[model samples]
Target: MGDLVLHLDNINKSFGGLSALSDVNLHVEEGTTHAIIGPNGAGKSTLLNVCIGRLKPDTGKVTFAGEVLTGRQPHEIAQLGVARVFQTPEIFQEMTLLENVMIPALSHRDGAFRLNATELLSKQGEVREEAEHILEDVGLKDMMMVEAASLSRGDKRRLELGMCLILRPRLLLLDEPTAGMARHDTNQTIELLKKIKSRGMTKVIIEHDMHVVFSLADKVSVLARGQIIAGGDPQSVREDPKVKEAYLGGTT
Candidate 1:
């Protein structure tokens, strides 16, 4: 573990009198994969939303690489080198796989995407080269020219991951990276994440699959009823009674 790359402190959020998060604090060390696991509606996604500026916390502070992210816009946070992969695959359905990846790379370099620059972006040798490289890294090079809509759910997830990789984010947050994958696809996704981990990219993952969590997470935090009940190295957190009871559906 290195210096803290992401920190959430004194966080609180509510919806019409229902508390969604309460005094939540989290720290993700640089170059490590941290898994946030919990029962449904435990505020895992909400926390991610807050970190990326999609949802405002009633009271809290989000810091990434020493910058306060609380009031920043989602795109602003992204421009600052934080990228998120949603629970559902978000991609350009009509665009070719290569083009889909190129769009982000172009936006990342130009600071914003322009419709008129679409053709010129495709013609950029450097951007196209990197996009092809990213597609290959995510195991989708063979289908680089195919439209994104033709891909399977697993392939789409891989494509989306490739899209994120083009920007080379400093911190990556993944919400259910393998949500609907079968065992085979899940294992492949895990392997892909491990590869990313080796490259020292910090990641915060919200995952429901215990297998995926255990396989990739160096540290684990369990959220229950909108609060963290246990947190530590994966093995210790897995053995914590509160975690077992709250997230694994076992008695404490």
Candidate 2:
């Protein structure tokens, strides 16, 4: 384990009279996968939103890579080496997979919107090469020119992850990366994540699948009703009595 790459302190969020999160504190070590698991209403999505600047917590602080992220905009957070992949694949449905991946690499080089053709032409080759490299890494090189909308659910998820990889973010927040996939596709995703883990990429994953969590997570934090009920290694947290009682059905 390395230094803390992400930290949340005294976090709180609410909707009307209902609390989505309360006094939540989480620390993710650098170069390790930290899995956050909970029941449906455990505030997992809410916590990710706060980390990525999608929704601000009513009270608390979010820090990433030693910089405060509580009030930064989504793009600003990305600039700070944080990228998020949502439960649903976020990609350009009308564009080719290659184009979709290239857009991010281009944006990473210049600004998000660089309309100057002269400047773009000068940098186009480098950008395309980077995008192609990313596509190859995510197992989509053969389908690079395929329309994103034509991809199956599993391929679309891989494309979205490839787009994030183009940015080479230090911290990746994945919200159910293997959601809605067949067993074969899920296995592929697990292998892909394992490869990324081998590269020492830090990730915070919120997943309902224990197989995925135990397969990848170095540390696990079980959340319930907006609070952390158990925190430890996979076996320890899986065997915790309170965790089993609250969420795991008392089974490992």
Candidate 3:
């Protein structure tokens, strides 16, 4: 019932005659956490790739904040206030965490990558301060000066999240955010995501972790064999027979 922020209409995609998605339709409400979940090879990530312009649907259009995003390039879609967090943390391995966070903000503000980025990054005082604040927000301020390559897996993920937050995107999409993490790190991420939720930033997450989904998602959509099988509140999705069958092999 909330305002429609992102809409995927009649989406179909294939590769080498193998269907990855089939007539997929999804509606994400403004200021809500919408989750896409399914067993392995379920096309949840494909759906997100379509939204962010990484993959073009053979048929269907993606609408975001009243903008048509189907044919646009990935950066173009990003310009329209969409940001994605890949399953693996994408950061400059040799760069410090603070610099990693600043790069995106600087690119967004200047409208493109800068050849003299290193020079400008240092000169942008306010941006540096903001990046530091965001690093702290993601619990990386203590290690802001350390190289990203030296950080633990969980810290790298946190750094990537801080990088995304610097964009201030209207819609955020995450792919398997807690894929490989200790329980403590996963729980910390859940709390960070919850804090982000409190700020009313709309999110669409593709996660396998049930605990993460239940903790953060306002609505849950179950994808099976490239089609949605069930969608509703977390509790409802959890109790749905279709989800039980597809996600749990009909056990219990």
Off by over 4 Å in 2: 111-115, 120-123, 250-252
Off by over 4 Å in 1: 113-119, 250-252
In candidate 2, which residue pairs get closer than 3 Å at backbone N, Cα or C atoms, i.e. clash?
A: none
lDDT tens readout by residue for model 1, 77-184: 999999999989999999999989988988888885456633655469998899999999999999999999999999999999999988999999999999888999
TM-score of 2: 0.95
For each candidate, how many residue pairs have backbone atoms clashing (under 3 Å)?
Answer: 0, 0, 0
Instruction: Indicate the residue-level lDDT of 126 in model 1.
Output: 91
lDDT of each: 0.91, 0.90, 0.90
Q: On lDDT, who's better, 2 or 3?
A: 2
What is the per-residue lDDT of model 3 for residues 1-252, given as tens digits with 9 covering 90 to 100? 399989999999999899999999999999999999998899998999999999999999999999999999998898888999988888899998877988887877877554763574457898889899999899999998899999998888888888888899899999888889999999999999998887778999999888888889999999999999999999999988778989955422
For candidate 1, what is the lDDT? 0.91
Worst 10 contiguous positions by lDDT, candidate 3? 112-121
